[model samples]
Target: MVNCMKEQVFFGEGMAMVKRDYPDLYEAIVALNEAAYTGKVLDYRTQKLIAMGINAAASDERATKKQMISAIKEFGVTKDEIVDVLRVVLLTSGMPPFTKGMKILGEVMEK
Candidate 1:
């Protein structure tokens, strides 16, 4: 399986600064990601699906793309699943934001 943590590219330049200043919070987030994705309440794949839905609906494209790629590589989620979530986001949040999210997600998947 792909190592999601190894490919975490979000916060690129900022993570080092954060790690130096707020090590506890960074560790907490890492723990949370591992626990949330590995537990019985929701398996990794299902967690990725849910995360994709939430991210696709959110306003931050960078965060959304990062999470989406993590889900794809770690949980084996497909592009179709990401697109499906975006489609649902379009219905609820309207087309404009969803369109932007789609473009961002498309770019991430292409890479």
Candidate 2:
């Protein structure tokens, strides 16, 4: 049986949505990310960090911080790393989304 814990942090369902909506483009992008990261080199933690960063920039605060904390615990991402990701999102994506993401990140870190 597949481990539930192993499945929890991955994005198979999201990838399925992408595939169903835009098969060619989704496959290409997935290929690109895989090639760039190299399956072995990227590791689950790094992938989770990138996902959290993207989600934060996209204004998905709840999902972003949920993923962020999970990455922190499972992959050992540091508070500084999380903060830096938030800063990058704020700089590139503007304040509204960034603020929301930051609020969540702060709450998670304080615990």
Candidate 3:
């Protein structure tokens, strides 16, 4: 399996800080992530897509970009698939968040 949580947490500087300064909290986060990303029913790719949609809906540009990049790299997720996810964001979150997500997705794809 991909161990999605580790892939996400270990890549970031903030997580490194947490590991050093708050080992217990970091461990708890690791445990929670293991439980959350277990792939028992939905599968990791679907979970990742859900996470991407959530970030998009929240207008979290950085998180949305990161999730898109990771989904593409790890799961071979296509641009069309991401666009489909963004369509849901458009429907539920309104234009601002959806447009922001689309812009971020474009930038990520360009790179």
List, in order, the clash count of every candidate structure.
0, 0, 0
Candidate 2 vs candidate 3: which has greater TM-score? 3
The local lDDT score (0 to 100) that residue 38 gets in candidate 2 is 53
lDDT of 3 by residue, 1-111 (tens): 112343545434377788889999878778878888888999989999998898889887777888899899889999999999999999999999999998998899899
TM-score for every candidate vs. truth?
A: 0.69, 0.63, 0.89
TM-score attained by model 1: 0.69
lDDT of all the models against the reference?
A: 0.68, 0.69, 0.82
The digit string of per-residue lDDT tens for model 1 on 1-111 reads 121343343334466675679999767666655665565776556766666566567666666777787777777778888888888889988887789888988798779
Q: Pick the candidate with the highest lDDT.
A: 3
TM-score of model 3 (CA atoms): 0.89
Clashing pairs in 2: none
The candidates, ranked best first by lDDT, are 3, 2, 1
Candidate number with greatest TM-score: 3
Query: Cα RMSD for candidate 1?
Result: 4.7
